[model samples]
Target: MKILVPLKRVADPDNANKVKVNAGKIETTGLEWKPNPFDEYAVETALRLTENGANPKARLGEVVVVTFGPKETESTLRQALATGADKAIRIDATDDQLDGDVVARALKALVEKEKPDVVLAGKQAVDGDSNQVGQLLAEYLGWPQATFAGSIKSEDDKSLLVGREVDGGTINVRVGLPAVVSVDLRIVAPTSVSSKHSPAHKYPEGVRFAALMAIMAAKKKPLTEMKLADLVSDAALKITYTGFELPPARKAGIKVASVPELVEKLKSEAKVL
Candidate 1:
């Protein structure tokens, strides 16, 4: 099965506390970039789907990763390539020049060009937290979609039975080939994926790390760059960011001298008797 996975490079989530808001926009200076955690999960899912459970090193089919950003974002694609992706495509665009709709439209065009059996991505980008691209892309392509997939089992490379995580509980749905799937956090679990070529086996939890050899080899792998305009004519952003600002700081907590004092504070000061 051929899979096209879309990835994004976002400010390192670990140092999110260091993020600052100025002039209604986030400060990108001195910020580190890393693959979105959820997108990383999607990459792992694609890798697992392409290979058998026992011999994962052998690529049964192709797994291509794509991203939208400037030249620096090539590093993000490289990282995915290092892990297991066969090829990488970097859309020449900046964060400010695009939105979810434009991204979906561009992806739709790219998918048509690549003609992959599946287009997979994270449910949302951590920086924006707007989970819209996958659904929008599915809508534009007029393909079946299964979102929030926690587990997936490939059946003869023709269809995938997906276990989706919902509010009440998990729901199972089967989508035909040439579909779109947005995965959830649980997707990286040891037993989250099952390929038709491989017997039942458990993979390590979380995204797999690249070996030194693989890391170096990734540089030699194919990396393609496409202009944002080449893929989509209407690059006009549908969504605009006016500004960003940090939330107000909260007051430090105080220790209560006794239970009665705590009760008093809760009743009056806290206003929750």
Candidate 2:
């Protein structure tokens, strides 16, 4: 089974306080770049699905990682390679040149070319927080989709049983092969992904770290580069960011001595009552 995992580079979520807006665009200066947390989970899920057994050294199939960003984004792809992805493909495009729709279109084109059995992506990118690409891509490809997947099990070579998180409880659904799975946080858990080869084996919690040898090995792995326009000639962004303004500063909290006082404050000052 061939799995395609789409990744994105984002400002270090840990340093979100350092992010700033300038001239209507996000300023990257003084910020660190890292793979989107959810995308890392997607990569981990793909790796787990393709793993041979509890043995970390055995791989049953290929995991191909792809991304859309500028030259610097190669670092992100390299990281995925270090995590045991067989190959890396970088789509040359600037941050401003692409949006959710354009990315979905570009991925659709790639899917047609690569013909992977499964496409796994994060439920959303933290930077934009617009959870639209996976659904849009599934629509473009006319394939079944499982979104916000918390757990995934390969029922066979041709189907998957996906556990999805809903408002009240989790719902399980079966999807055929050649489908799209957008993963959520729980998908990174030890037993989140299972297959015939390793049905009962458990992976370590969180994304696996690459050993020094794997890091060096990734340097020799195939890394293909392509222009975004070459893949989707008429790609156009359907949304525009006019400007950005920081949210209002939070106000300090006040203490109420009793329930009646709290109700009085809610009615008089907070005005929620």
Candidate 3:
């Protein structure tokens, strides 16, 4: 089966965060970029599904990785490729514009063109903490969606058995071919640098092109783009920023010599147990 996985670029978790004022709006800056942690889980899930000769009933075909971000995001795809993705496609665009709706629309276009049997994405992106894109893309394609999937298995050669982690327990659901699955961290662990599989090299020139041309060329590689005008539900989501405030600075706490003094301070001034 042809599998499609959408990856995301997010702020490196180890870096300190800062807000930049762009036209009176707060924009995140001063941070290094890394693949969203959840997407790594999704990718690992996909890889695990095909590994160990698990899908022997029907030979697993290929894993295609897709991502939407600035040109630098290709590095994230390279990481995925090293991790075992058969090939990679990147939609070169400004990192800020990759919202739920825009990314869903773009992915819908790509899915229509590629016609993959399964599409996988992270439960949410860490940078925006928005979990809407996978569901939105599934809605756009009129495909069944399973979110926060804990485990995915092939029911037969034609259907997918998906396990979703719910509040109290897990729910088992099945979807026919050509469905979307968003994975939670419980699905799998992040792929390390060494476990990556090397992909066969394709034409370098077509692979490395300018941003504008790269997007144009992405259309040729099993991608289709649709405007909100063409969607039925127009259910694509938008994030609105209203205001921003800096967190209040914290004051240093005084050290106490004994447990009694700490208890007294907490009871009198701090008002804690």
Candidate 4:
């Protein structure tokens, strides 16, 4: 079974974030980039499945890691490759403005070319936090979508039994081949960087430019592009971006010295029962 894993580069959650003012647009720059934590789980899950020597699916073919980002995204791909992927595919966009529709479009194009048995990605990307790409991609491909999968085990050579996290609890699901799965972080723990699997360090200084070239080069590396028309035989889903607004800053709360004072404040001022 050929598996395709999609990864996204997002702001490292460990750092402080500041919005940048760029020609009236808020630019998220100067922040460090890392894989969406949930996508990392997907990658690790793919590796685990492929490494299951005792299972027949363990003999599954290549593990391909795909990403769409600025050239800096190559580092993320290399990280996946170092971790365990057999190969990598990088899609270069003019800019990092890919929304769920565009992402699904691009991935749909790629999937048509690769025709993998399974596709996996994170439930959401930290930067956009839209949590819609995987579902959209599945829709575009006319594939079964098992979303928010916390754990996946091969039920048979052509089937997967998945543990899906839900609002109240978890649900068990079974899906056949050629399905899309959006993974949760608890699905798999990522492999740490080690000497045996260190990412490519010698990247160019201008990563965006380099990444564009690398995407062009990706055509030679088992990559293919699909046109917008080919992506949707019917009316394509309407996708648009309207305006951006910053949320109001949260107010700081006063610290009370004792539980009694806190109770008094809650009862008298905050008006809680």
Candidate closest to the true structure, highest lDDT: 1
Cα lDDT over the full model 3 = 0.68
Ranking by lDDT: 1, 2, 4, 3
Q: Candidate 4's residue-wise lDDT over 28-126, tens digit each?
A: 677777788778777766666565423312334577888775566777887766555667877765343456787787788889888888898889987
Report the C-alpha displacement of residue 84, candidate 1, in angstroms.
Answer: 0.7
Tens digits of per-residue lDDT, candidate 1, 181-229, equal 9999999999988888764779889999999999999999999999999
Residue 54 Cα positional deviation in candidate 3, in Å, after optimal superposition: 9.3
lDDT (10s digit) by residue, model 2, range 116-168: 99999999998889998899999999999999999999976589999999899
| Predicted structure 2: lDDT | 0.90
lDDT of each: 0.93, 0.90, 0.68, 0.68
Which candidate should be chosen as best, given TM-score against the real structure? 1
* Residue 153 Cα positional deviation in candidate 1, in Å, after optimal superposition: 1.1
Error of 1 at 68 (Å): 0.8
Q: Which of the predicted structures, 2 or 4, would earn the higher TM-score when compared with the native?
A: 2
**What is the lDDT for 3 in model 3?**
81
Q: What lDDT does model 1 reach?
A: 0.93
